[model samples]
Target: MRPVRGRWLSWLVGIAVALGFAVSALAQDEGYCGDEGVWLQILGSGGSELTDQRSAASYLVWIDDTARLMVDAGSGAALRFDETGADMAGLDAIVFTHLGAATTADLPALLEGSVDAGRKGLLPVFGPSGNDLRPAIGDFVERLIGANGAYSELSSFLTFRNAAGYKLSVREVSATGQRRWSRFSSDVLKLSAIPVHHGGIPALAWRVEIGEYVIVFAGSFSNQRDRVANFAKGADALVVSHAAPEAARGELREYHAIPSQLGRVAARAEARILVLGNRTSRTLGRESQSREAIEQHFTGPLVFANELECWGLPDKEDELP
Candidate 1:
């Protein structure tokens, strides 16, 4: 009995020591990293097709630990955002690449969630203007939240002067040219958008520069390689959709860049990192072949963005004196 009691006591002591060390290590890590850098999180990385493997396209950009910008509130994005434990109150702006259901379907959900989480004031939203086939972003928002439209209750529930206290201000950009427009600019960040070709549908690409880190999102462009290359020049990270493989043809090729094209574009832009997002089963299944094709052109670090994964931005090295 005495020996058994000794062994039990020794085990308890060992467990306590291990727990103490773990706690100390956690504290040290928190102290060292403490919300001082910019980070990118993939809220949903799947394409338009409904699948159990991944959510539709969405992303979050965090600056100094604050979730400041969101791109695309796609299907299941709100749930994924909630899982990140990021304060919705800190979200300042949302940029929708297009008005496709797979890209903007969850906007109402995210707005409602933000209001529920005590977000107050106006939230700016930027999206492409209307073409012959698509409605402009301003009209799209009204259709979603207008007094006589779907989710009309949201207008009252989520207002700047309402009890929850939050409202959305929509801005639409022309979808006619390769001209770059400044969306938002502040001391720490600058955002720019450019019109891109997407099967005659209104679409746009976005570039964000936070400090010395530059990230470009090439949203659904195929034939406009020059526009995309200019928009993504010298990007620290370039995110390309993987919906269309090299074998895609006809109308399908008009909307999305193939794997080889994506790699070539990344190389042309001189990007340091290439992130393949909006992945479908077709693309995911051909990962090895796709990767090899991408490597043929782009020599940078290629990353496959997955849902809820966070990537830290590496600091730019100082130039020689």
Candidate 2:
């Protein structure tokens, strides 16, 4: 579904500033997902709808106390990233599901800020290969920061000619088949992506591996392929973009996972916990129905993720070597 960016975003700055204070206070009081584990932090849990007054789909993967990985920087996500007190420069990589505005609108805003900060580091951006509708991630970045791009003023991101001395390493992956690409692998983290069905739109489902913990970001997907089930098998946490609820129909239902389908996928994947993210107002208002629909198959923990909520992954160090 297309994310509507309207005048509501003008109201976001003030509301976010006020909400940040309350959330920060709550975080200080209750403590966060701990400083020793792999934590899945929801930055923006709302869908493309401007009606919710929430930031669109974005997330962070915190390794220990530092935010090391980011997934999808959607509308208002740049602001949410700032509010979290995260060091944008410390991020190892930023991955996108598809190049929709709901998942990519704030990218240049974020990178521009990083450039201003004079952060010097090569950051890799991983995203899906495009079809006729969308440009591949590489072309997408070139269009934004290439020598003669829309933001040609910030073309240094491509050429690295400026003092900040940072350049984007764009890695475009294909989501055209059953093949799952091993995108990034390091001592602390490993990432893999597989093709997912989002109708004609090229999309991916990411699997993040940190130590013994596994987390899945089922970006934006429909249940027709069930690619996520196998890709996310044995995941400790599965973050599904619940953009459409069980009652949604036609194109709305075709682009996103309905609650019942989500449940079956979670159950099949055997994910330990399911976090429903990228929420729409419709899904938010019908929580009872969605929960019932999901619980029918996935009997494990079900979390209706709220922005800034950090869910810790329990340690399985002993189980791993």
Candidate 2's residue-wise lDDT over 166-193, tens digit each? 8888999997988889958866899999
The reply for model 2, stretches above 4 Å from the true place, is 1-30, 116-118, 317-321
Q: What is the clash count for each candidate, in the order shown?
A: 0, 0
State every prediction's TM-score relative to the real structure: 0.86, 0.87
Compared to the true structure, candidate 1 yields what TM-score? 0.86
lDDT of all predictions, in order shown?
Answer: 0.74, 0.78
For all the candidates, what are their Cα RMSDs to the real structure?
Answer: 10.4, 8.3
**Mind giving the per-residue lDDT tens digits that candidate 1 earns over 1-321?**
000001111222234345642111121111111165776777888986866478897888778867788989888898888877677788777898888898988888876766567777777889999977889998888889878769887766435666667777788888776577995876577889988888889998999998788889887788454588878998877888888877778888888888888998898999877878899876877777887888899766666767666655655652200
lDDT of 2 at 28: 23
Angstrom error at residue 166, model 2: 1.3
lDDT, model 1: 0.74
Enumerate residue pairs that collide in model 1.
none
